[model samples]
Target: MTVAALAEVADVSAVEDRHVRLAGVTRVFGRPGTPKSVHALGPIDLDLRRGEFFSVVGPSGCGKSTLLDVLAGLSKPTEGTAEFEGRPIDGVPAGVGVVFQEDASFPWLTVADNVAFGLRRAGVDAAEIARRVDYAVGFMGLKAFAGAYPAQLSGGMRQRVCIARTLVMQPRLILLDEPFGALDQQTRLLMGDELLRLWRETSATVLLITHALDEAAMLSDRVGVMSARPGVFIDVVETGWEVERDSRIVSHHRFGDITGRLWEKLRTESLKHLRDG
Candidate 1:
C-alpha cells in the first residue's frame, strides 16, 4: 500500500463537522490510606474543533497520558464524560485513529500489510483495502521499503509506518500520544513535518499529547497545560499556526514566541508539581 492510495480513500470533507468535547471529566485511583489516591485526570472541559490540531502538555505524571486513555476508551473516568459529536465516548470511537509513542507496526507484517490491518478489521472489501493501504504507504513514502518488516525499518520509518496505518483507517479524529518522543532531535523534526503534511492532506481533527512544549506549539492550534497529579487543565494557549500548515512554519518568527509562552506555562505548572511532591 502507498500513501497516495490511502489519501485517495479519504474524503477531506468528512472531517468537517467532527470534534472532541470533554466536560466535567475526572478520574481517581488508590486506596483510602495510601498517600492520597491519584486523581489522575479531569474536571476538564474543552472543545476540539474539526480538522484542528490540539495538544496537551504537562510535567512527568500530570495525567496527560491518562487523559488520552480516557479519550481512547482504554480507561474510564471516575466522573463526567469524554464525548465525540454529542455523545459520551464508550470505547474507541468509530473513525478515530490512534498513534502511540511506541512504534506499533507489527514486527512480522510488511509495511503494506500493516497499513491494511485496521481496514481489514473493519471488514472493508479487499479492493477498498488495497486502495487505502496503497495510499497510506505512498503518503508516508514507504514505496522502497513497503515489503520490509518492522525490524528492517529505521525508527523514523517505523513511526511513519505507524502513521500510515492509522491514516489508512480514514479516521475522523486522530489521537497521537507523544508519537515522536523517542526519536532523536533530527528525526523528531522530520516526523513533525511529515505529520503536518498528513494533517493538511487528510483534514482530521487531531489531539496530540506531548511533554515537549515546543513540539506542541509547533503542531497545534492550542496547547492545553495540565496540573500535577489529579491532573486537570490549568490553561490553554492558542497557537495561530494552523493557518499555515506548511512544514516550514516551524522556522517562522511567531513560532518561537508561541513556543516560548507554552514553555513558560508548562514550566510554571511543573514547579507546582515539584512543590506538591
Candidate 2:
C-alpha cells in the first residue's frame, strides 16, 4: 500500500476509538464581544478515546472547569460543537458522571444512602440499587463506613463517597474536576491509586481537570496543558504508561521526565495567569 493509504487507515482507526470530540468550541460568560463578557474557552479541539484517561492542566482561571462543563452538557459553547459518542452533547449526555472539586456529599445522608441516591432517583429496582451500591462502597473502601454520614468522615473519605456516588451510575464517561483538590498531598496521591483501580475495573473514559502537574502526570494517559483565560490547549503530553499502572509508578525512572514535559508547558501559562489576574 502507498504511504497515503497507510496514513488514511491509521486515521480511520483513530476516529473509531473516539468517545468524545470538541470541535472549534468556544465559551463566553456573557454576550459575545461585549466589554463585560469573559471569553473563557475555545476554538479548542479535543478528542478522548474509549477507556482512556485524559487530564487537563492549566493555570488558575484558565476555564478548565468550563471545558468540562461543555462536555457535561451543562454549558453550551458560544461557537463550535461538543459531541459524545458521535452525537452532539445535549444536557448531561447519557451514561456520563461528574465529580466536582467541592465536597458535594450531603451531611444528612449515610454513605450507602449517598451512593444509592442516583440509582433510586432513576427508579432502579430496590434490589439493583442495593447491589450496585454495595459494589461501589466496597470498591471505594467505604464498606465499613456505609452507615456514616459525610460530616463524620474525613475529607478524603467524603471525596470517596462522592466518587462512589458517581460510580453507582455505571457511567461510561467520567468527568472529574480536581476531585481531590481539598486533600493533602499524600492523601491526593493515595486517592489517585483508587482512581486508577476504578478506571481499570470499569474501563470508562476519564477526563480529569487538575492544577497539580504531578497529579496529572500520575493519573492520565495524556495530559493537555492550557493557556490563561480565553484558554486553549498549548500542549498535550502522552505518558505512554500502561492502563494497569498505579500511583506507585510515580517512582518509576521515567516519571520525572514525563512531569517535566507538563511543567515546561504549564509554567509559562501559569505565569501569564498571574500577570493577567
> What local lDDT score does residue 197 receive in model 1, on the 0 to 100 scale?
84
Looking at candidate 2, what is the lDDT of residue 163?
98
lDDT of 2 by residue, 1-277 (tens): 9999999999988887999999999999889888999899988999899999999999999899999999999998999989898899989898999999999998989999999999998999999999999999999999999999999999999999999999999999999999989999999999999999999999999999998888999999999999988899989999999878888888997899989988888888888878877
Cα RMSD (Å) between model 2 and the true structure? 2.1
Identify the candidate with maximal lDDT.
2
CA shift at 128, candidate 2, in angstroms? 0.8
TM-score of each: 0.89, 0.95
Residue pair clashes in candidate 2: 25-43
Q: Per-residue lDDT for 78-192 in model 1, tens only?
A: 8887888667899878888889998898998998899998888889999999888888899899988888999998889999999999999888889999999989887887788
